[model samples]
Target chain A: MNKHKQVVLDRNKVLSQIQRLAEVAKTDNWQYEYDAQLDELVYGKDFMPRDSFLFNVNGEINLFISPDSSVSGIHIEYFQANYLAHNQELQPALRAITKKTIKNQRDNEAATALEIELSADAFKSLFSKDQLITVL
Target chain B: MPEQEHILKCRDCEGKLVIFHRHNYDIHKKKHPELEDTAFFPDRVRNALKYPTFTIPGNGNSVTCYYVEEFSINGIIKYTKVVLMNKPYIMANEKIHHIMTAHKVGHVQEEKYPGLKKQMYHNGNKI
Candidate 1:
């Protein structure tokens, strides 16, 4: 019979892994911020906890790591810019122009926003295999 | 002084209840004075239970409970396990619950607890 043993992680080891991830994020255009009082490490571009990223039009992803080395959650928000006609007559004028033209114009003028939360496992998987190996 | 204890019951199942013992901070502070002001203190577990960010789904009303235990580990004073028992008398997901028990030895192995459901969320939201 084989006996299975659980692997307990060292506190320092866990922190090191999180720091390594943050370092990698820096090269990926993510800024790193640490709160000593909350013991939370956050990395992302214009990221805020539980709030939508309003500053940048680029995709925003926020990763939160708690003091215990557990990942709280990852918040991802994608933003796309769209152009709207300032003149009220533009719609009617475009309709008279061509049906195909309206379709193309609508497609170009559509904005998109997506917000999602990734599970802990999914968040960890985002890290490179090399980074994960040391922590494991 | 006797340690404080709290009894939590499943809102759906009135007869089902679990007893959770509060941590003895005095004893723990003596053992690990360095963690006196940190969240690592055993009392933090109690505080987490009192002010949980989320709860487990139960039949009708939601249920809240803590499954605390103590272990002998280096540089650690105590280990507290908080379990949110839901409807059908199910326990919280092991993977998520283990977050609180990380870096410490568990006095009771998880396998010892049976017939507990996992991944049931209350209020349809999660922290």
Candidate 2:
């Protein structure tokens, strides 16, 4: 009997394994919600943050910073009419992402009340290089 | 559970303030239950509002008030105890001032509101 067995890689199994890895990587994508009633756009990490306090950023935006000084979330009041309208370049992409997030939340029966998450690609495309630096 | 409320005499507006049982009963509890060691009791909150270090106006006549006590060494502020009124509630109502929630925060830059300090003086000390 041969002491060592020859290992064969199943091509389909390998492809599926790679796809699973890609999905796992998307889990860290940022989540957002445009609350119509509040007229605010809340963008942040998906989980409930440990006790955070609001730090007003230029009166319009509020950054929720944790005790550790990490920025947990961002809340932009009067989002569409004020914030987005003023920044015309950010409007199209933001609106599209918001719509898609809402639709996804409505479709997923198991989705919690937390803000809907953006897909990996959508999250990456949401902000330009400068915008990302400024916002963060 | 029986309803418990705290009737506070707001020093800011010099009016009656009410903290309903439901407002600070659960997560933002007045007294910490056996579950946790943290507490945001009413008395401390009321005291902070009465002698606030700084206040900033919010949208729609609301105010974000803070009662900060600083500890300095050699003219350098090393630590600060910050009691923040988290919600932008109606704090100016002479008839009845209803403040919503209050929480403690970490060190905050006093230079954030430069002009507001002129209006925020307590015990002859410029806040």
Candidate 3:
């Protein structure tokens, strides 16, 4: 196959993985919506642009799966307040991390939510770094 | 139709790095007729070599970087090259290597070429 075809196939494989995660979300009652045209699966409705497709794995952790297959990757974003309150010393270091960016902020509180894009393999392993779970 | 080879060299090692390879001139000419006009072609080629753009992942677009090199075969320019530089030590820059690595991973925008982001955005979910 051509290189471009290979890329499309690889993206489809990653999309299948995300589709499995979406199935798990449905069973867990995580509150999700899927737009077939957009290929976007949003998890929470109240958040709209912010909360659209976030899967609240627990009360603390939220997962946002990007709709576009071309950029097929999972974004694991932490609720800013909850993350900082528990881990204070790590905040400065985390803030220093260049790739980590703040997203989905609201007017009510400070923009505490920070997200890091993870590769398909990393997402499959639930963002495990050095055999340690980086995000819960 | 004879095939011509083009090589893009790595500045650090000065090794012949082949980044782009094309064997058909007629198809290339059909794709880029602007390159056929010899009168103003050199200037246009110079401008293209001066401003090479690389696609940024997830941004669905490419941004021009200020580094490039042009290669010619038999007085006919074949391809342009970008030199990867080190911020500190001359050793292989990990950042550039990482970007290249990330690019290998399946995360690029769907658009085939550059400057198509506006049209893709307007299409919206259709793509």
For each candidate, what TM-score against the reference? 0.20, 0.42, 0.20
lDDT by residue (tens digit), candidate 1, B1-127: 2324422221211223333323422322222232344544435454434433333322122334333333333432233434442433234521111111111212222222243333322332232
Each model's total of backbone clashes: 3, 0, 4
Please tell me which predicted candidate would have the highest lDDT against the true structure. 2
For candidate 2, give the docking quality class from DockQ.
incorrect
Model 3 misplaced stretches (Cα beyond 4 Å): A1-16, A22-136, B1-9, B12-86, B90-102, B105-127
For candidate 3, give the docking quality class from DockQ: incorrect
For each candidate, what is the lDDT? 0.29, 0.40, 0.27
Candidate 1 CAPRI assessment class: incorrect
For candidate 3, what is the TM-score?
0.20
Backbone clash total, candidate 1: 3
The residue-level lDDT of candidate 2 at B7 comes to: 40
All candidates: DockQ? 0.03, 0.06, 0.01
Clash count, predicted structure 2: 0
Candidate 2 clash pair list: none
Report the candidate with higher TM-score, 2 versus 3: 2
